[model samples]
Target: MNYQTISITLLILCLPQSEANDEAIRLGLKQVELSKDLNGWKPVTQSKQIRYGEWTTNAPIGQVGTGGGWGNWGTSVVWEDYKTVTSNEFERASLNNGENGLRIQSIEPFVPSNATKYYQEELGSFIISPRIDLSTTTQDSLFFQYKSNTKMNLEIWISKDQDSYWGIWEENPNRFRNHISATVAENDFTQIKINLHDLLIEMGQIFCDNERHDAVINPETNEVYIAFVAYDNAERRLGSDPKMIEIKSIWTSSYYSDGQLQPAPIDPVISFDHKCSSVTISGRVGETYELQTSSDLDDWKTSYSFTLETYFETYPISDFQNTTMRTMFFRLKHKP
Candidate 1:
């Protein structure tokens, strides 16, 4: 049998935008920074200089009435401290071992009367003025512990710009919060991984409760703030409201430098070499292609390419040299 060699090159276009976003989300999760142990996470109250329960008097607050009482509610809380540690306190506190956890002991109280009378004392009951940097390439995960006995209400908010223009991203209006319950015991840590993109999606859902929503993507500026607010369903005492719940630990992991979704690396190029009667093709394991042969070099004929099976077989051609006289060339054209 006489053998003639023919070589062909194949080119593939870029992937679709949706496929790229999916790949980015997958890789971004894998590149999480600082999966710290929960044990290493110390409470924010541990800072001696920052007094505990020093609530601000001018913070923004929100309220939701469940049935007969203020059991299920939502509000934003804010505090000012001179210490650098607490400056970005919430973000810093979120960086803990996956095993470490946080829980809500009690929720801040706010009575919502049908009347719009100004209650100066209740004005700033809860305020969260978080500085969200759109520039940061970090993926943050949060875990909030809640008792199974009580109804749990929670909400998270984010602002691409500043708190003045903040908006809600995730909320559990009246449903019991779902958490990774532990076998160890009550009050132990239960974790939830919240990606930045997820945060954006959740916020979009909140903004578009009745319509469609879109998430913004810009890497040039810092423009987002995040907030986590919870409510207690337990009854209150005479002397005081339920002791404010404590957040055990908050964890964060840094991601791709740009902080936006990215596409996966391009797959290796595929090419084939045909020796008239014999053809050898090289390609990535998962890539697919279709081989072809031509007599006039203008109109081509289809042949087999790589498949799930180890190697692809082509039909045997008789008189390789004589066939090439009529069919002079062969090429591998990738299938769409």
Candidate 2:
């Protein structure tokens, strides 16, 4: 062909406002077909995997008995031991999973030597986790087994500074790795998986971009940097603590979405093509899509349906060769 023919072809390929036409290229062939649509659902062929297992081993962050001060007020470069950090409230226990877990005991309320207005409000322990990079993950969750004597509460926190637990909590925006509160009130050795995304949303609401609707979440600034913190926050009553909690086989894993945690269904890509006198609808393989067209966007009519046999199969597109309109809109519905 000549330059004139090439120019016309490029124009035809680029004319549509279709999302794919914008970022694609055509080689010796026609326009590179459109990309998959974002709205439809795809099937997840396999279970979610820990692309990178950051906490698979017994790698506690700080050295035991190295933390300092009351209520964890010291610069503990290492993980403080329960025996040393908890004013005699926490202990280390062996888990049936062959991994170690934490044990928290209720202690008698100490109103301080000078039981004055400054009564010991609570007794607790703090331990740091090795640096964790949440940058590449869309989901992060904690899995563990715990048994409680009475009601027990704990906080999972992140911090940029290894020593700014209080500073971060106090809204020193630059230091704190927002905290998530969890509680266990039962006595059975129950297993629990805590998804962190829910709590992160709350943190974003309070500390993200000062609450801007159009604000973008910069994971590099917001999540890339942080050390994990697991600590106890036991409220003291007059009686010896009853609602005690012991945890075993503690670790964190990152996945893509809530569905990815188990066998999940993923949405496939949907797109369409414009031909000489008809429209072609297509989708990825091993998936079926319903094609619908509408002239006013408000009302739509089903045109046809097609399913791809293989991921690479040249699946035929649904064609509409008998129509005449200045413009048209198409939407796709995925079928399991």
TM-scores, one per candidate? 0.30, 0.33
lDDT of 1 at 101: 27
Q: How much does candidate 2 score in TM-score? A: 0.33
Once superposed on the true structure, which residue ranges of model 2 sit more than 4 Å away at CA?
A: 1-86, 95-99, 108-120, 149-151, 163-187, 197-202, 209-243, 253-336
Model 2 lDDT at residue 13: 50
Which digits, one per residue and each the tens of the lDDT, describe model 2 over residues 171-259?
11232234322344233455444444454445444442343322222232222222222233354433435455565534443212423
Candidate achieving the largest lDDT: 2
Candidate 1 lDDT over residue span 1-336, tens digit each: 999898878898965222112333543322212235323222222111212122323322354354545443443334322311111122222312332223444433332332122212111112242333333354333333322233334455444433243433234233212321222323443334444545543443443443322233222124344455444343322233444333432333332233454335323332322322222343332446665666787887665555411122222233122443553565555567
- Candidate 2 lowest-lDDT run of ten: 25-34
Model 1 scores a TM of 0.30
Q: lDDT of model 1 at residue 203?
A: 44
Top candidate when judged by TM-score against the true structure: 2
Please report, in order, the local distance difference test score of every candidate based on alpha carbons.
Answer: 0.35, 0.38
